[model samples]
Target: MIRHIVLFKFKPGISWDDPRALEAEGMAAKVGGEVPDLQEWSTGRNISTRPIAYDFAVIGLLEDEAALDRYLVHPFHQEAIRRWREISEWVIADLEE
Candidate 1:
């Protein structure tokens, strides 16, 4: 299985209650249900106050690289990414497990 992980940092001065932030958060929260080849999906806001912490995270599992690729290009995924782009920056990691 491929474990796909993403970490997001909200833009400076943006609050979690902001409309755009809420929309992006909602999209990320629901993407797994709307996409295919996703074996598992989870996302959440960060509770840590440490400097190294990001504001949000997404952890998901796919069958393999091909499925991971499909998830990347899927419309629902793209839409979530688009919404996120407006309010944050993110990084990702993919691991074979």
Candidate 2:
């Protein structure tokens, strides 16, 4: 299964230039470590784009939907998301395929 994660609308002025933002993404990526089913992980902070809906995009390929859910509720994910929420606003969607 392919799971796409996009996070949008950070607090105004939080740019990719911010070291904190960069570190946050790095930490978020680490969440994949806890889930063995994640076949591939791709993530990035938007560099330059016109009218992009999100500030970041993280894509995960997993063995199955259950593994995707594990990725969502993973302890590292909870920790990383908690930290992100403290710094910015966000919205996400799960595309099932």
Candidate 3:
């Protein structure tokens, strides 16, 4: 399996209540249901005020690298990524488990 983690930092001045932000967050959280290859998935807004904390995160597990690739190209996942790109910058890490 592969553990895929993504952390997002919203652009400065972007409000949490913004419709784009809400849609980006919701889309990320619901991606698991839309992408069949995802073994697990979760996403949420950060409650922390710490400067080092990202504004949002997505944690997911895929069956393997191929599954991870499929997830990346899946239309739903792409749509989520597109929404996020308009409002944030993000970092990602993938680990074999």
Candidate 4:
């Protein structure tokens, strides 16, 4: 399986990020069915309580390298990423497991 991880920190003065989180999570919930080659997907938003770890994280489990590449170039994922970039700072890592 391919595991895709992302961490995000919201930009100052941006408050719509919760909706972004919801949207991302919602989309992720639908991935395995709508998009081929996905095994599972999940996303989480940061709570107001502070933690030493990175802000928010998203975890996606996919079928293989090709599926991961498909996710990378998928239009829906691209759109979500564009929206995310507008709202926050982020870091991403994709791993094989």
Better of 2 and 3 by TM-score: 3
Give the higher-TM-score candidate: 2 or 4: 2
Candidate 1 lDDT over 1-97, as tens digits, reads: 9999999998898878799999998999999899878989999999999998999999999999999999999999999999999999999999999
Error of 3 at 56 (Å): 0.6
lDDT of 3 by residue, 1-97 (tens): 8999999998998878889999888888789899999988888878999989899999999999999999999999999999999999999999999
Sorted on TM-score, highest at the top, how do the candidates line up? 1, 3, 2, 4
Instruction: Tell me which of candidates 1 and 4 scores higher on lDDT.
Output: 1
Model 4 per-residue lDDT at 33: 61
The global C-alpha lDDT for each of the candidates, from Candidate 1 onward, is 0.94, 0.72, 0.92, 0.71
Residue 59 CA displacement from its true place in model 3, Å:
0.6
The segments of candidate 3 whose C-alpha lies over 4 angstroms from its true place after superposition are: none
In model 1, where do residues sit more than 4 Å from their true spots? none
Q: Please, what are the lDDT tens digits per residue for candidate 4 over residues 8-93? A: 77777655446875565566455546656567767676676674555567778888888888888887777777767866788888
Clashing residue pairs in candidate 2 are none
Q: Candidate 2 lDDT (Cα, whole model)?
A: 0.72
Q: Candidate 4, which segments miss by more than 4 Å at Cα?
A: 16-33, 51-53
Query: What's the CA error at residue 48 for candidate 2, in Å?
Result: 2.8
Q: What's the residue-level lDDT of 60 in candidate 1?
A: 97
TM for candidate 1 is 0.97
Decide which is better by TM-score, 1 or 4.
Answer: 1
